[model samples]
Target chain A: MALEQGDELPELSVTPDKYLTVRYAGASGDYNPIHIDEEFAKAVGLPSRILHGLYGMALVARAATEAGGGPASLARLGVQFRGMGLPEQEITVSGTVADAGEAVTTVHLEARQGENAIIREGVAELRR
Target chain B: MALSTDAVGTSYPPVLYAVGREKVREYALAVGETDPLHLDHEAARAAGYADLVAPPMFTVVYSAPAIGPALFDPVVGIDFARMVHGGQAFSWGPLVVAGDEVTTTVTVKSIEEKKGLGFFVFESVSANQEGHTVCVGTWTNIVRGL
Candidate 1:
């Protein structure tokens, strides 16, 4: 793929569910109640069990990797958790090639669940 | 009590984790990844890897245990009940292949108190048995005031 600055990368949409969250909890070893127990989350003032922020970041990384050709192409990825991601919501990841260098390509990324921006200040660098 | 800034610069002992092919495949599937390199050993070998490769984020699975010391330190006084993940950053070096024995060391990078919340940064560096860096992950946690 010919990557260039100002080029928009393909968007990736992921709809997480309770089952996925449970599996992610087991896979990631992050058994935080806010992510696995709805009753605990509600008792703690959350609307419901929230998805792990790393999961959303992984989706963003997947978009970068897909656009860069493969997983090995991605060199760095960073994101700030801006808002909570609830299960069963379609989270959309979009990005633009911010800079394309001879050795690396930097892409600016964002992930949103509906109108709420769940991940902000996202950036990914891929080896060229 | 808020998290202590004194813990900054503390380093934990390296923890060893064996990356198995089945574990890698299970993580890839759980993350909704369908790439052949992560599931098929032959395909991965054809792609220049020794065996099934792990997804970039899979480092979190192996590195999570290394951070337990810092997160649960009594001196740091971190309240798990009020803490939330604030951010995450990763820099990859080499792909983690199946059967690779990885060692990770967790370090408390920084800690800051602001607006009644404690922001702590932890860095984990994972390297293969050959001492080649596999990945470095930085995790941020926010501990809200009670």
Candidate 2:
């Protein structure tokens, strides 16, 4: 089903774990130890090996894009990383269309771990 | 060791990074962004974009790479590898379409040290081949004492 304006997607969840961390590092060439190795992360004062903010944003974007339509549909995808998403908490991603025109659609996205949003004020623009 | 506030005015010249369709697609895939505008050139043209435009944040990776040397320069005092990416913000100007040759200039905005914690901000402005500003981003990194 094509997502129209004011549409909200079903809940999708992701957990930040070691395997996902490795894939993110390999894919993006961002091998910051704070994201992959716990000992190194602790040495630097992080609570634990944490998920890359972009990785979480990717999950949210994936849902928004899929729901909106397909690859050639999006015109813009923007997100601001708010709080750290940890391995222990499972984050749920969802979106609502903010506006729509004849051939264009805008989506508002958010990823929450429990009630707290780790990503805030995300938007995706898609062409219909 | 802490970041030098004096580093604020340093400017890093632009570097060429050929944007690959696969990279854009992979990034789109990784983020679960299936926007056809990012994957199909024809679809992008139909939508009024020249070619496959990327996710709004994609260019940051290329431009941020331009600051790699400054972030690691020993004289800069901060250990780039050990630092954490505290945050990032972007203000979009003109749209960044695919196949556009772009130049990015990076400058350090400020450095602050307090209570044994050091924070630094770096900003980059990316322009199209025609010198249109595509986006401006500020990245904050926080470092802890070793």
Candidate 3:
């Protein structure tokens, strides 16, 4: 697929199971109680155990890379955590080629849960 | 307690991580990555990789030990109970595959107050066994005020 400017990458959607956060915490070695212990999360002012911000970021990165080229083609991926991500809700990752340059291409991507943007300002740089 | 601005520029000891095939596969599966390059060695080799490729986000595991000090430093005083991930950025260099040894060095990039919250930034650089950079990551955290 030619990465022409304005070309849309195929959208990827994932619904993390209720225990996804726990699995992610273990897989990523980011055993923060706020991501696993519901009681601990509530005490800390969150509604409940929330997904690790990196989990959503990774999914978005994968979506961009899978479409742009592949893992090795990804030069950079950046994102800001704008909203809390709860498990059991469907999250969608979508993006468009923002700049198709001779040497590199940029993809403006985002991850959303319902109407909320969980990973905002998503940017991915792909090497041609 | 809030992280002190004085902690900015503090450098933590470098951490060495041995990239394992199973760990790489586990991380890819955990993130729901279905790419065979990250899951099958033969596919990775066919794709020009030496082994199963570690997805870009695997930097989280390889750099965590180096980043831990800044979040736990007493002088820095991060309020763990109220802290949350704010943002993340990564720039990749050489692709990381299984059997590689990665060493990550971390430094406190900044600490400041923004909108009554404490914002902390840490910069980490991971290098392959050959000393080629594998990834550069900027990690941000926000601590809500009392």
Candidate 4:
């Protein structure tokens, strides 16, 4: 089913812990220490071990692609990371149609972590 | 030593990056993007692109390392371990296909200090083998403790 203007995507959640951190490392080849070790993160002044920024963005991208119809349908996608996402905290990816037509639709996307928002804004363009 | 804000607008010497098909394929697969336009040059030409265009976001991985010397310049006093990504944006003109050799130039755009925290904006431009401007990327990093 293709998402239309004003259609809300089913909310997706993730609590990225050490295992997920390692998984993302294998998948993305981003070996940034702040994402994997608590000591490393604290040594750098982060509150705790954090998820990779791209991983969080990837979740939002996955949500948009799946909810808007699927992989072969997307056109343009863009995201900006705002705040750091820590481990064991739940991240929620959600979206609503920003605009749509018979052949294509644009969705406003977000990924939020509790009281702190990791990614406040994004746009996903998908086609039917 | 603290970095002097006087460095803004200075462009580093261009670094040549060899575009590898395998890297492009890995990125596309990781992103779950199976667009043939990003993989098969013949298909890409059929679709009207110059060749197998790399994904727009992939430039960051190739060009970011070129800025490391300045980012960690002893005079700069930035601790990569303490740095936090603030934001990033890309403005793409033409597509960068696989098998294209490109030159990348990175520059510091701005730095803002507030309450002992530092926010820095860095920009990178990637040009094609023929020196055509292909994409421009602006990324922000925040450093605490002024």
- Please tell me the TM-score of chain B in candidate 2 relative to the true structure's chain B: 0.88
Please provide, for model 3 over A77-126, each residue's C-alpha lDDT reduced to its tens digit, 9 standing for 90 to 100: 98999999999999999999999999899999999999999999999999
Greater TM-score among 1 and 4 belongs to 1
- Give the poorly placed runs of model 4, Cα more than 4 Å off: A1-30, A36-49, A58-80, A86-93, A96-107, A113-116, A123-128, B1-3, B34-52
DockQ of each: 0.81, 0.24, 0.86, 0.26
Q: Backbone clashes in each candidate structure, one number apiece? A: 0, 9, 0, 1
lDDT of 1 at A75: 94
Q: lDDT values of the candidates?
A: 0.89, 0.71, 0.90, 0.71
TM-scores vs. true structure, each candidate: 0.96, 0.70, 0.96, 0.70
The TM-score of candidate 2 is 0.70
Q: In candidate 2, what are the lDDT values of residues A34-119, reduced to their tens digit?
A: 87898997997778887788777667656765676654455566676767777757889988878877877788888988877888
- Which regions of candidate 3 deviate over 4 angstroms? B1-3
Task: Kindly report which residue pairs in candidate 1 clash with one another.
Answer: none
lDDT of 2 at B127: 82
Q: Superpose all Cα atoms of candidate 3 onto the true structure and report the RMSD in Å to 1 decimal.
A: 1.4
Q: What is the lDDT of residue A33 in candidate 1?
A: 77
Task: Give model 2 RMSD, 1 decimal.
Answer: 5.1
